[model samples]
Target chain A: MGGFLAGVVGACAEAWQEVRIHKGRVLLSLIGVAVAVCALSGAVAMSAIAQQATIEQADSAGGRAATLTMSMQPSDSTATGRQQATQAWFDVLDRYEISYASRVFWGSSRVQFPDSVQEAGMTVVDQPYGEMHRTRMVEGSWFQPGDSARLAPVVVINTPFWESLGSPDLATHPTVTIDGLGGAKAVIIGVYGTSSWDTWPSMFMLTGHFESLLDPVQAAGSMPQYEMWVPPDLARELQTRIQAELSGAVGAQGFVSVDRSDWGAQMDDPTTILRVITMVIGGIILLLGALSLVNIALVTVRQRIREIGIRRSFGATSGRVFFAVMMESVVATVVAGIVGVILAVLLVQSPMVSELVSFGGISDVPPFPASAAVFGLVVATVVGALAGLIPAIIAVRVKVIDAIRY
Target chain B: MSLIELTAVTRTVLIPDADPLTILDGVSLRVEPGERVSIVGRSGSGKSTLLNLLGMLDLPTTGELSFEGESVPAMKPGRRDRVRGSNVGFIFQQFNLLDGRTALENVTMPLLYARGPRFWGRERIAADILDRVGLGHRLSALPGSLSGGEQQRVAIARALVRQPKLILADEPTGALDVETGQSVMTLLDEIVREENAALVTITHDPAIAARSDRHFRLDRGVLTVAEGAARNAGRADEPVTDGPVADDAVAVL
Candidate 1:
């Protein structure tokens, strides 16, 4: 047992010395492995951060707004039925103590700016409440209550509308004409910003402003669209109450279609898809890195054939040679793994990397998990052992007599 | 009792796509404890082959060989290796001292292979052996850094370090100059005498053969006693001349 231990120590010392003497080669090999590990870990970290950011953004946007769409017959021209439906919804919401903003629905109409005319789906709201239906203004300002009753109608336009209109300074522009609806001239009161309405061109106006453009009879016949915001936890109860009251007052056909913002649900969320792709890519890179380590260990063993023979000649048994070579490979791979983990941590912490992640909409850097490091080390060691097996066998099987002759 | 015994020992070399070649042909020899013997032959005369067979590095094709009266031809490989490690020491023609190791480490190698744990006391044993071989000052120097004569002395130190019962040297001084070779031979003789170990040195150098207690000539797969004038003739062929009477009276066995 003592002799075996001594042999192992001697072999380890020799292996270390050889590595030291060929420092350049060892460093090169280590760099190969380190780069592979860094790429893998960096990719996983970046993808995870990006996915988390996207989910957070989606939740923030979707959680705040509650919408309900109702389908009515196109020819249902009775004001009594629309009024009853509106009253029923209002009473249900009031019963639940849920504060909501309502928008009267109108069909699609085109709005004309000086340089560009865009078709914007129109909706009329009485007032903004609970920060839920309020659009943030990028330039100019939101419509004031005083502007609601002005002779010329005041309208709020989204950013895309302003940009499409050649970015004109429409802040002081008193009035603009709408080709459809009533063809009345409307005043541009404010410009708001949002990525929420990216799908189509859209703008907002007060119910009075919209009513001013339409004839009294036409306005009376038009169905009003309503959008409401309620706390997410109270949503189910609120929805149930609205449905019950609307069905009772407006007949069995009267029903509310509650729409919860499902930004992530659409297209399965690109960020999550990207995260899964990045993870697969990272896993492949790690596997290649492990293979490279094995190749290096095998080559080292082949190169040390004569040395192994000499050790055997000195009375090292086959088992001893096998263990010594395997130990050397494992030690080398573990060292590389540690260095790789350090480099990965440093890369993730770098200012440039963090900035890039933030630019991709991720604000927080994920902490380097201890589990990842442990897993990497264990994998590297196993790769080392696998790589060492064949070579170790060859080393042990060397004939003492043939080795001395050489 | 003979320290080494060989009965009808034969070693053959088998090569693919070639006929089998016999290197040692049913030759037999023996040496008692404390006896210094030399086997002299030309190149390829089976001298080294016989040495290898005796050293347990090669197995005989059809013969029973013994070391210290124990049958070695039939021993297991592990047992053979153990016996070779503990009971037999070898000096090679090229001075096969591990080039990377210091002189002391080279000498201490056999002891390091002992079944027991190595202790600090192994260093003392190595030091003593190095001192005996007149290389006390060069103990820390690697074999490659040593001169040819110094390296040969280190090899001799290594061979004797285990205190083996038998020493097998194959042309131990074959690569050295006349002066260095003489010093090396003198050192080998002195160590073998002091340790009471049987020494069997195989060389083509007749002068070295004459210096031993008994000299045997190997030629054409046969061993023969070279005595009287023929033994002196072998001595006269020495690269360095010394002690003409001793050379003339040397007996062959």
Candidate 2:
């Protein structure tokens, strides 16, 4: 064991000396490898951020992972029929002990404008809706549990809706009037930012307040869908169990259907697709880098024929010579790999890069993945090993007599 | 036992789409410990091939070969290489000094493969040997920065650093002027005597051949003892003549 360790240490020292002697040539090859590793590592790190942005985007559209949405059709178009459906919703929630769930109603609310009254999109939801959807707020706060007890409706408006109302200060208790529905006043408690795809004015309201403003006939016509956040592990099994349980709970007064509505349940998950695409591109980049490195290493070995012969003539065995040649390349690339990883970390963590990769949406970009940096170094070592093989073989095959003569 | 022995040793090479070429024909030679033997041959007369054979760099096509009573041909390549490394030291006409290394580093090459104290104290051993060769001041000098004689002395330091049983000097003085050549040769001979190690000098120089204890001439792949090839103690080459460095060189050794 001691002899083996000595041999390895000796070979490494010799390799380092050779690398230092040929630094000019080593530097050029290392440049190619460094750039390749940087690009590959950056792509991996960026993918992590892209994945977070994609998840939040999906959460906004279809809610978080494992969120099941429930919808019901009433036996009759009457206020009592809708109330019975809502009662069934209450019973199921109480029985399951689920905490994060909300019933969402989609409609438009009449707003009093300076010149005339206009209709803006509105959603009637319970308090848990904003938290479940990762709703980004530009001002004020999301709906609180006590919001249900307010005499006047409390609403969260999007930027455009707030702009239509002159972007008022929430501390002053800004209110928008319901022009067509008995002229009811609604407090604008918060302003939520809009995604790039969203431009139209929209607002959110608590279910009780929205019902208080709109008449029973109109409230009965608005479609309400059930959503609840549950443990992802139990989602599939619970999805199956909920379908049967809810069907029985609502009984013959309504037809109920339950389905997993998160973007993850859908067939085309953009985040997974992004990861696969990045890996394929990164792989191609590394391969090109390795090929160039191998070419340069082969040329360098050919130039050192006499050196190899001298080492052999002294007492260097085939294994020692082979390992030394290979270690030279390995040492050079590992140093390059470290440089590349550092470059990648700095670039990925930079503000402009983070914003660009997240599409300007992800305020909390995920921390640089430690796994990505480790992956880069590991891959560089592997590439160095592979690139060194042919050159090492050529070096060991140098006949001592021929090399000395040359 | 002889330090190295070759009986009826032959070396042949086969070329693609051509007849086999014979470089050495049934050469036989033996040298005991502490003996100095020289072989002289014209260019391409198989002196190098014979030197390579004796150095274990090439296998004999057919023959009995032994180093200190161990059959060299029967050893594994790895074992044979180890035997060669531990027992034989080679000095080239061109010096073959590694270009970018210091004189001390060049001398440390053979010791890198050595185990125990030799490997650990390689630099010190190298420095000591360079000091013996009158190159102690040039230990840090690269081969390119050194003169021809200085570079050859560094090569000699490299060869002897391991203190091997046999030293093979292939045309060791072919690249130097006559006086410097004799100076280097005399230095080499005295060191081999001090170390009590066998020496084989392969050269075409008659004066260099005359300095050895015994001499053989190689002609067209055949070995024969030349007339008047025996070592003579009072040879004209030994008196230094007008060569100032010879006195210095021999005196240092």
What are the RMSDs of all candidates, in order? 9.0, 5.4
Pairs clashing within candidate 2: none
What's the TM for model 1?
0.64
Model 2 Cα shift for residue B24 (angstroms):
1.4
Alpha-carbon runs more than 4 Å astray in model 2? A110-119, A159-191, A267-269, B15-19, B230-253
lDDT of each: 0.68, 0.84
User: In model 1, how large is the Cα lDDT of residue A348?
Assistant: 73
Task: Give per-residue CA lDDT, model 1, range B1-253, as digits (tens).
Answer: 6788877777788999999888776667777888888777777888877887778777789877898888886787777777887778888889887656789877776665564433335678889889988899998898778999999999888888778888889999899988899889998998899999989988877767777777676665556555442345445444322222211322212
Segments of candidate 1 deviating more than 4 angstroms:
A1-7, A21-25, A38-306, A357-364, B1-4, B30-35, B66-79, B104-112, B119-128, B160-163, B192-197, B224-230, B233-253
Query: How well does model 1 score by local distance difference test?
Result: 0.68
Span of ten consecutive residues with least summed lDDT in model 1 chain A: A68-77
Show the lowest summed lDDT stretch of 10 residues, model 1 chain B.
B240-249
What is residue A385's positional error in candidate 2, in angstroms? 1.1
DockQ of each: 0.21, 0.57
- lDDT (Cα, tens digit) per residue for candidate 1, span A1-406: 6666665666665556556645665676677667766666667666656665565455434433344433332223466666666677677668766565555555668777665676776656665521444345666776665767688777776667666666668756855567776677776667765554374656677876776677767766656655566665665666666655566666665545555553532546658678778768877876787677667666766666655655554455566667777776666666777787778778876777765664443323467656556655666667667766776777777776777666
Candidate 2 chain A weakest ten by summed lDDT: A245-254
The DockQ for candidate 1, computed on C-alphas, is 0.21
